[model samples]
Target: MLEQSTRSERGSMTGEEARRAVREGRLSCQTSSLAPGYVQGNLVVLPQDIAGDFLRFCQRNPKPCPIIGMTEPGDPHIPDLGVDLDLRTDLPGYRVWRDGELVEEPGDLLSHWRDDLVGFVIGCSFSFEEALLADGLEVRNVAEGVNVSMFRTSIPCAPAGPFAGPVVVTMRPFSPADAIRAIQITSRFPSVHGAPIHIGQPEQIGIRDLSKPDYGDPVAIRDGELPVFWACGVTPQAVIAAARPPFAITHAPGAMLVTDLKNSRLSIL
Candidate 1:
């Protein structure tokens, strides 16, 4: 009975249930472990001056940076996200960058709000993770209670003026059978980084060590479990940090924006 209680406490909520919790301030933390079968997004807010170029960057590189929904310049609402969604405060956490350097990490984007900033929602690994879980495969980060580790690879992005940098990927270690299931499950969600780019060879992508990642926390790779890579939405944040635009905003790593759209809606077929 005690073990049952513990398991129930650790159990996650459904997508719509969690979204309502977030709106009510009951669940104001990482959305990763919140909604088991919903879509969560990585966010990027930039000046109208650079948004056009950035759009092209996403266009050129859809795998690592799929655009889920975008807002008009200076607008705070993305109707597709939610009816009451306010870009300034709906999220749990935000990262503010000034002149290309990270300057502040806030609970909301209200103070940093500007008339020229535009919001872009990128399809996140949460979609793919849901697919994996549905196939009865374990996601190590979800199992271990940590952010999925992200790495910057030697691979270059198709340069778009000042927005060019190496592609970044998130790693998850799975057994061979689970890994194959992950590949097939994720392949259906093309908008959210479909399938594995490189599996089992971390060093080939300039990732020197599994324990040391550029961002997020590392998880164990059990015996016979191989590490798999997927094009990550975090790639844009890395690029923005390197490009150093005068001002930028991003969803804090792992604290993604939960949209009204369902994960199933993102599946290409």
Candidate 2:
């Protein structure tokens, strides 16, 4: 367990340290702005039988469902992502679903673990945020201490078997000029949802209100700032729910699996 005195330094914690705190029950909160430079992932666990279709679904929708790492059937660790990363407890939170209905949000998956389950770690947009901040752009959620605003959009993802749903997106308000720069900056991290899919008007993408986001918290938009949308990793949560698999588990939105991999490693340029 992390010492109580180290709590204030959580923002600077290494990926392994952060995971240690989370696994030890010392921390339980949305992990946005934590462990900067480490790649964070959205978690999805499913029965081994249906893992193939879900993998194809990710392949078909690379922007929102990029595969960063995965575990073998019944395995709880992803060595490439983190040497000691445990799917059962590294994340701050977990969402358990059954028959398309959310059953519980647990702190750990110890009770739900099964011998036939498979885990997938999807790349998170939060990983590319370091590049945005390094370039001097304000990441509203980080600045405001909140999870990035996410919403379901009208844009449909290419379906693969039972996995299919409208694309979910994360929004950040920025000036017209900054939006373009954000696009250029984010375009380098293709594995972590590269580039904005839409800018300015949210309604064109089926988002009716900026204040009321479907997942995570909404940030304030400035006078000249426009709402920029990026395809989000949370899309799989929606897809899994709509598919109504008998059993499935995902990281709670905003609560991600912090991995040992660095953000710089994912950059194409």
Candidate 1 per-residue C-alpha lDDT over 200-254 given as tens digits, one digit per residue, 9 for 90 to 100: 9788889999999888998998999999999988788888888899999998766
Clash totals for all models, in order? 1, 0
* Candidate 2 lDDT by residue in tens digits, 24-56: 887777776678889999899999999999999
TM-scores of the candidates are: 0.89, 0.92
Candidate 1 contains a number of clashing pairs equal to: 1
> Which candidate has the highest TM-score of all?
2
List candidate 2 segments past 4 Å from native: 1-5
Model 1 Cα displacement at 254 (Å)? Answer: 2.3
Q: Model 2 TM-score? A: 0.92
Error of 2 at 48 (Å): 1.0
